[model samples]
Target chain A: MRKNYFHPKNLDGVYSVYQIEGLNQDRLIKNLKNGGLTLYNVKKIANHKMSLEISVKQDKNFFAIVEKMCYTNLELKPKIDKKRKKLLKKGVIATKSECGYNIKLTRVHGKAYPLYYLFTHVGVLIGAIIFCLGAYHVDDYIFSFEFTGSGNVVENRVVEYLNSVGVEKGKRFSEFDLNVLADGILAENPLLSYAGCLKRGNKMVIELVLAKNGTDILDESIKSLSSDVDGVVKELKVYRGTPLVGVGDKVSAGDLLVDGVISHKDVQIETNVLAKVVVLAEFNYTFISQFDDRETHAELLAIESLNLPVEYSKITKQPDKDGYLYTVTLYYNRVFVAG
Target chain B: MSFLESVKEIIGLEQFPAPVFRATIIGDVAGFFEGVVDVQTWSDEQIVIRLKKGGFIINGKNLYLKKYCAGDLVVCGKITSTQRI
Candidate 1:
């Protein structure tokens, strides 16, 4: 029961109508005035029943005061009259009866927490889980391997060689060190002048630049044929340049059998030396059978690596018995802490 | 004059000489009365009020005191009957 309970109808506010039964109009008026509340309107509908429109300021405080007056009337005795008076001064509703002064205030509404907060918290947790899973998928293992180069070499053969050298695709993206893989490829193959590997999205691209060998690319240049072994040249076919020595010529290793320079009208023209030579040689050799003395052994190797996504091991057969022991020593570097 | 009559005179001079005790029944739910000297006996179902003259008995279900100030008394419930004792 506060003076602010009733707002002007044209204004935006809340008001409550309470029926004060079993009480006289005078007494009711006096109690409300004492509680610091001005009754906006009081309509007597019966001899003992009246509709009271009290001015409400705060809903919680107003409702609590009303309820305390309604339900705790019997408890508002002389012993707690002082407390009751204090509550009344704060605009609490109290009425006197034969039993005692009791309070019966019914609450209709106030500041309550909305029910959607629980669902909102749960939704946020689920969203976070989904985000984490999506991040893991996007940054997961490498999807495929792509090889690019201009060479006469077979693509499958290069891919297999790269796999052997640990430049494999489908491995975890974080575990791959592109610089190290390129270095390893260049080291293993002397015919490749350039080798590089890079990641594009989920795909790993390997680039190779083959070194120009004489048998691959032929152009205008000076070259000489050298015998690979001690032999007698039975015949010769020169496709370019000049033929220095004819058939039945005996040539040793490192001897120039053809020349690539031609002189016409005192102008020397240099061209690539190209020729095909057949050689006949005689040799005596001794062969030994070591199938009975040789042994084949395989060892299952498993390793847990830190830098690698998953731990893996393979059973590699030793080239010789000593090779197995050497491979076991290399296993020490594979074990690392998992990310 | 008795002490109860003196209290009744002081608290309720406006309704004086009309009735030593006046009880007004509102349907069967509530009762408003004056000239209450003291609450002699009380319970959820029955309440006895010592008025300036004789006492009054209020009978009902869920009967509760709504307010009491000096000689003014308001009792609310499913008030069935009120009898002069």
Candidate 2:
């Protein structure tokens, strides 16, 4: 219980208002304030109205007396507003506007507080859910393959080699070794003159240029045209004529491995022809050897055990040499020996 | 002055600064005017410029400017061009 004193011009004396659960305005005012109180201003609060600026004699226990008088012998007849009562009965006005204020305060505070909190909380939750879903479903995060060079020569071979080396679509780019794989692909397919591989995001892209065809092979028959180093003919291809030698044949470095000779002296006229031959002359080599003796020992031996009524014998021997050795004597508990 | 020196001066006066001239600078003098010279000594594609007082050969894409003689005034599309032919 609380008491407040307020003044009004219409009132003859100061009005002391009792702020309890119910309304008993006349008695509350009369009991709270004696005849000596005088009036000044009035204002309305949540459940009731009261006046302020009332004059009272200053005393040590004045506030205590007022508080006691407001609470003592209180009778509450709820002065419910008829409009509010009608709205409540009809259940139509869920929220009520304060008489002078622009904002509407809900009649049920518990329901309104959660409803307000839910609006913002649910909005944030829904936004977070949408963000997560977008992050999960978006395909913008991807691997990209970038290629370079003229379209005709090296592009197809590079792409084919990249695919063969397990860098196909949908594979992560980090799994590939760009330089090693590029070098490997170039070495494997001689047609690719040069190749460079790069990884971007989850994609592997290769750039390559093809070696031009019709590059001149040295005419060794004309001894003037020869390489400084002697090279065994690992392979030989005759574009204009037949091959002179099969695989594993030897020929000198300046030897005419490919001959452009024609035998037109015969009755049958021969055309200008070329022949290819393979040669294997000499090569530098090195050899290496490593062996372990422990493995060989384990493979040669097996364990054997024999048991009698009161004793046992254990032995380790090779598996294949059992029948050759004869048992000449046997000892029982070191008492007697027999064959 | 000698006859060659007079002829050189006259030729320099007559032509557009005698488009091509050879100058040799060794030791400390090499550092003073390094990148200031823009001369093409090889084909027009290959231009010799100074970098850190050392010669740098820049290979450009176009080669048409190579045909001009040593002292000829070679101009291309309003760009003043000179070279040591």
Candidate 3:
């Protein structure tokens, strides 16, 4: 058995040790002696068929060496710490205890190149590049715009107006300031009662509430009309058009009371006349009731396959029809029937 | 590829075409061995199986065959060592 410190191939100053479990000691020792690693010490713990510890200097192909040793005892676990490379690079003695062995590397003034240190720096650089790519990447600019609550105004005209003011579809999200764009839209269009611009991911949602034009009452093209029910006109007030009926006059349904045209200075001017005509009427109403009660038919059939077994099932007959009829007079008046 | 093979791949059918002996150890408590030719030994302390290429011996405590169907077998226990010969 070699009792001296073993020098590992491809590594300087830094060394490693492994504690392998559930492996044959004689077979492992023989393999290690021929495996080209400078073996330092081999120790057996108290428990038989339990654990073995081996220490050696760092090797370039340490992982490959461990994998080669793994097949002998299929369950053999060699614990190694790749993080010690950072500490070793800083010239600090680092020790890590694992399941199979304890690794201790001494501090040295000279530089020791470790594969783990190179891999760590390279991994950090790659990670930083990936983060930068994610932060700057932009996908799918705004492709469509949708409008809601734009009534009275023509839809195509509203779409055209939006397109004219740079609020059209296919525009990028970064291209416009939302608040400023909404304010500009409202300023340019006086017909909108409320206007809003919203960016929902890649879609622009535009909400528009159109202002109601109350000038319909003064529009000349509107024709005047009378009371809808037979009643005495209690009050009458006309704002623009000519009135065809006066107060206290009896009018029936479909009677025209106001005309949407006024004659002034021998010329007829057409305008929508605003008026309020209230009519008071009195009447009585009645309702009728009807009902029926009856019953019919009951049958049953049994079925089975291979083994015929009769099953007894209970059949219950329930009432098929039930409801109500209500008749009431709203006002005290004689009911008249056409004979 | 044939139409059936393409459809199977698309639907993620991972069954091997031929029955080949394979064994997988999950930590030290359980192992699943498939395509087992024969079981040479079975007990609470050890289990020996014959595979296509060689034989494997599993030594443990409280070992038992959890399941066996066709050529597949599952053994579970507090396993200590596994050796191939």
Output the number of the TM-score-best candidate. 3
Interface RMSD of 2: 53.9
- TM-score, candidate 3, is 0.28
Q: Any runs in candidate 1 off by more than 4 Å, and if so which?
A: A1-121, A151-154, A167-169, A213-339, B1-85
Residue lDDT tens for model 1, A1-339: 555422322122333445555533354444453444534334444556555443334323434544544522423221234655666556454435432433333221222212222222567667777998987877656778777886324344467567776655567777767888878777776678788888777887788888776233444454656665455676577776667667777766566677777778999887677666655432212212223322222112212222222222233233343332222211111110100
Per-residue C-alpha lDDT of model 3 across residues A1-339, encoded as one tens digit per residue: 764333223345433434444434445444444454344323333322322222223333433454444322222123234443443345343222222433222311123434433433576667777877865443336777777776424344466567777766666777788787777666666667677878776777778777675222334445675555665666666776788878778877778777777999999987766666655542322212132211111111211111222222222333333332222211111111110
lDDT of 1 at A238: 76
Question: What DockQ score does model 2 reach against the true complex?
Answer: 0.00
The global C-alpha lDDT for each of the candidates, from Candidate 1 onward, is 0.55, 0.37, 0.53
**lDDT digits (tens) for residues B5-77 of candidate 3:** 7876887774746436678899998888887655565556877877777888999987766644456667788
Give each model a TM-score. Answer: 0.25, 0.22, 0.28
Show model 3 residue runs off by greater than 4 Å. A1-140, A150-154, A212-339, B1-85
